[model samples]
Target: MSTPDNNWEDHWRETLADHKASPPSTMDWGGMEELLEAKVAPLSPIKAPISSLEGKTLKLPGLPWPVWAIAIALVLALGYWLGSHTALGVSQEMNTIPKKTSLADALTPPADTIFDTLFSVGANGELTEEIISIERAIVNRTTAQKSPEINTSLPAGKSPSPSTPVNLNREKLKAGSNDIAPSTTPAVLLSEAKAPTTSPEFFTGIRRPDTPSSAPGLSYDLSSKPTVRPNRGGYVRPLKTLSPPTDRELLEQRIKALSLSEKLVITPLRYKNGHFPAYRPRN
Candidate 1:
């Protein structure tokens, strides 16, 4: 008698042989065609009604057209009148100018009795008898101080006294009057000529120093001193660079980098010059 395992193996061999001979007639799939057609058919779309406002005329309230037209006309007329008058006014103001006159002529004294009573003719109005006497006294005192000569004439001058009669010369008075008049008016001589050397009397109160002040904390040494600067030096670290890899490490790195990916590849035409081709997938 044979074992059950052997029997089962023999049964499977027979089944496989029968299948290879006729192949089980191919399954009947014609019944599923109706289900596929039903799934493929699309549904009809829903329709909506159009709005009532379409194809209709727009409505608005009535307005007064005549009033607006009159207001626009009035504004245009006023602007035209104002523009014409402004140009005419400016031209008239610029064309009619007044003449110029001298200030000296306006300030001159009038030849009437009113002006004559207020202002007299030459030095008479400016200086009275008393003022003249005062000026003469000042001039005499200055002359006496400058010149020490006596003013008496007596053969050999027996003696001069306060009671002696002094003669006043007209030439001296004329020269003094000319000098005083010019001095009161302006410094005309100072502008025309250089000033003379001042007398010793003018510098009587001023004095010069013989030596510099030697007071404590009052002087400073102006000489320059030499500066000593520090000399700085230090060491700088160099930058690091990569060394070449060993043969074993290089092989291991290449093997670890192996990979697969989907990419696009193109084929060039052998006959075309600049027109190659479009891209295609290399799958």
Candidate 2:
């Protein structure tokens, strides 16, 4: 009933129709829609801003370990150099301080000068003169202190006899001075008077009180009160007790009684020592 073209079309359609169309299930359609939404929709900015920011990582080139180590070492070396230079300057300043000399070094005398002075001939003469002068002074003092009264009592016009200690000492000193040194001179005369000797003439002027001499096997009365000896030193009087005044005598004495207001007034309130009185108010 059809043409050849129509017949061929019908034949192909019939063949294709024999393989039935299989439509998708509800679960599969739902799954397909969820996947499409997840792929197409944009994420919320507030919920994942950190993740969005983290995605763009900076990739800068890091320095090498050796370079860092070299830089640190350079800094340390610079610091050490500066510190050491400062310390060196301080040490140099300390070294410039003047050192003090010791006490022993300052006090020590020059050996050569001392030795020269000691060996000099003039120095020896001076020392001998000094010693002889000292000896003469001593001898003169001894003769003056121990001189006999007879020697002192001689007439001023007459020269002392050669036997007197004063004349003998003076002659000896003159001889020594002449023998030793031309620079030496006689010493001054003594001022103190001569001591009196034990001669009978000295005792004739002085009279001593007679004292009783004790005999052997002689005993004195023990019951008798001893006599008070005369005191050569100053005397002191003994302390004495005095009787107290009786209450009847105190009552008999008159008192200048003050008024009640005067007694109550302070002492500073009273006029005294050219000061005007300042009276205190009564309570």
Q: Write the per-residue lDDT of candidate 1 for residues 214-252, one digit (tens) a residue.
A: 111111111111121111122222222211232223333
Q: On residues 50-91, what C-alpha lDDT tens digit does candidate 2 reach at each position?
A: 776676887746999999899899999999999999999999
Count backbone clashes in candidate 1. 0
Model 2 CA deviation exceeding 4 Å by range:
1-62, 101-283
RMSD of each: 42.2, 41.4
Worst 10 residues of 2 by lDDT: 208-217
Candidate models: Cα lDDT each: 0.32, 0.35
Q: Per-prediction TM-score, please?
A: 0.19, 0.16
